[model samples]
Target: MISTKIPFVIFKSFFNGSIRIKLDWESLISEQVTINMSFFEELENPSSWYLPWYLNDVDEEVSYLAPNARQLTLADIPKAINHLNSKRRDKIQELLSRFINSTQPVQLVIATYALPDGKHLIMDGNHRSSALILAGVKARLMVFEMFGPLDPELLPDLRLWKD
Candidate 1:
């Protein structure tokens, strides 16, 4: 839950300015209450990276995208939940409990970056990252840290960290 200060974020619209919303900076965004993706699994584009300061190298960036944020379509959350990664399925199931336990609004960061194909990328708020595709949540054009032109094919996958 957020108690410190209101933060800014970024958003990439699939239809309107809502689809994939993201946060900026690592500390501003809380650790995922749950992680649905396995170290070896492939994920949808529009992933996330966090840091104390904006860093261009993937090795220096922190945080990974959450599974709940990767739903392909935004028509229904119920349907998307079913497709969440299998390894951390139990962890994600606990999100509802977290919501029930607290009434405070959880803090999220919005990040905007440029992908290799010239498409813009939004990083942050895994919960709402796909909300636009799932629940049609509206956004206020959140602020973000923008990363210019990154190579999707060159970016490292989660497995790359398995030293």
Candidate 2:
């Protein structure tokens, strides 16, 4: 179950319109994709969506956290925030401020694909999602299953990107 906190009206429109279309992420990423402003404004509750990253209390390390590959909601934000240090918390605040002040549409890249359990693996945009939730702007995500846990490999891509 790909946990998503989408509004009823947008949900209806999403299935009925081009808002949520399935596309290849590789191709889609090349083109500039922006979430519609209406989508953000219509979110009923931004606090109910799930996030993908969490901090481990034992070693104080950050891990890619999820429940049975299920979605995490904004309701879970406080716990994640609480686990973070002052620096990380401050970053979230900065993102919230920028999101609130910007009139431009928020740019995002939500990598979606199916898991072995037949669940959808929603990856990327972890911090931005949290920031949006904190800013109280909600939007339904359009999921595209271009790849699973790995596209070119069998396990998670442990390699970090370098620009």
Candidate 3:
């Protein structure tokens, strides 16, 4: 049910003048998309919310690692969007309508699995990322590197991208 076995820690590093955060957590079980949604409540005003607020009810001992932030560009969006299913694609379209012409900078929590081929399998943030892409808005991504048993078959609508 996505319980953590240890306290989460955030590590910061400087790479080429940019800050990179590395988060390390243990024992996260990937679940179906709908089930995963229960872990975080939707914010009424997206701009007012930060990633940590979503985990307010989650036990501190089991926290998701927060890595440093990086810029998400237009070139990266299409590749990532290709990984989502039609259902998620529709949601992104919905969000696009609202986010279009939005000047507020977008920041997102992106979770991924590092693959052998150097690509990342996006385990979370498909909707937000997709919408941001459609709106032609660049974003700062706080990437969470997920380490555990992740079955793609369980989440048919995940996106894949190279960072």
Candidate 4:
């Protein structure tokens, strides 16, 4: 069983002035192939803000939190999806198949911002996360706690886009 006592380590500081937390999930699912989170580099200079393309039309206001990251269980998945404002059924099932049939473990980098009421607004990786829930996989997500406006231009240090 994966220990819930995992310590939260402040990983590194990014160009956009945000610190990522280094989480150790190696022991959780040893059979799964580990893919290091590399989306941070792509976010440094995005040609278009549409990389995390799903949020383009979302009009909700996002709240900020201090840099925080933690492990979320399979049970927490549904609540996170609820923040998206719409349940995407087809997209989740499609990703679910990819997750179950793949020979290698798929590393999903789910990012979310904290809501004022202590809820999370999943900014990216919703489909993958939902699929993981359906697959009954307990995974560690690299959830970046964001602050400020949702506008790409107004985001802190041009590090607004997520995937």
Candidate 5:
């Protein structure tokens, strides 16, 4: 677990709706492997935007609540590729195989955004996360990028770019 010894009152405010989130920006930069959720979405589906930075930018001032550091195994996470087409699935599988053969550690990127329901939404890295699951690896390091105050009701309207 990645514990910074955050106070209980902070957690309380986060869930009580007083605070939007509890994000650690330091970790994201130090890791140098964060997936920009906003950018990923903009790339997947072109949308009208005022600026290029807006394409991938996340608001730093917005606070969010996320777990200290989760030491998760395969059973801990949901299947990341359920929504993907066969072609994408296969490509991911190939990558997974390569990963298995390599000496490098399997570090997965996870983007955590606050949902109105108070649960963190796991975005991106489905393929890599799923690969970790399939390999039956326990305790992989998952880097998190946090966003939100997003309405849970809007979840239905949201979809990952799979094309």
Candidate 6:
């Protein structure tokens, strides 16, 4: 489940009256992608959604969506944020602040799996996994989930990209 969060937009245009479309969330991240961080950042701006370099050339493997069972949200800091300091502290704080100030819901990605005992395990989305701690989100996640653990023998060959 590829849940990349940002501001959610709800409005109407002459093309579609009374329509609702959630602007792709630009702050929340569930899966990892190799695109340049700047490229992703540009997508957050309404004007950048159509740029050719935005989402440019994504790997097919990165397209998998995670199920909600194999994920969990810990109250502690997200692993990605624990290392923040002067360089990115303000940016992170600003992103979160803007999100809270917006009138939209937060987005997240979760990886889940079922157990023989009938319990679910969420392997990801610690920042906001539980409802009690859920940010202003209507849907808890939007994931690009991958299947069972990879078997090296069944993996595909790698190829280099060319400009």
The models' CA-based lDDT, in order, is 0.32, 0.44, 0.39, 0.39, 0.36, 0.26
Top-lDDT candidate index: 2
Colliding pairs, model 3: 21-67, 21-68
TM-score of each: 0.33, 0.44, 0.41, 0.37, 0.40, 0.28
RMSD to the true structure for each prediction, in A, is 14.8, 10.9, 16.5, 14.4, 15.9, 16.6
Give the Å shift of residue 111 in candidate 2.
2.2
Candidate 3, residues 44-135, lDDT tens digits: the string is: 22322222111112211112322222223334445434443456557877888777756776666655444444344444554675576567
Candidate no. 6 TM-score: 0.28
Across 1-163, the per-residue lDDT of candidate 4 in tens digits comes to: 1112211232123212321322222321232222222233112111111212121124231322213322233344444444333445567767888878866556665544433333444445656756766665434444454433333332322233232
TM-score, candidate 3, is 0.41
Q: How far does residue 65 in candidate 3 sit from its true spot (Å)?
A: 30
Clashing pairs in 5: 2-69, 21-63, 21-64, 21-65, 22-64, 22-65, 39-56
Best TM-score among the predictions, by candidate number: 2
Worst 10 residues of 1 by lDDT: 33-42
Per-residue lDDT of model 1, residues 1-163, tens digit only: 1112222332223212442333322432342211111121111332232211111132222234432222122222344455445432344455444544444543234443433343334344345434322322223333343333233322222122223
In model 5, the number of clashes is 7
Clash pairs (backbone) in predicted model 2: 47-74, 48-73, 48-74, 49-72, 49-73, 49-74, 50-72, 50-73
Which has the better lDDT: candidate 2, or candidate 5? 2
User: C-alpha displacement of 124 in model 5, angstroms?
Assistant: 2.0
Q: After superposition, how far is residue 65 of candidate 2 from its true place, in Å?
A: 9.8
lDDT of 2 by residue, 14-91 (tens): 433332322333443443333221222233344433344444534242544322232344566755676666775787
Q: Is candidate 1 or candidate 2 better by lDDT?
A: 2
Count of backbone collisions within predicted model 3: 2
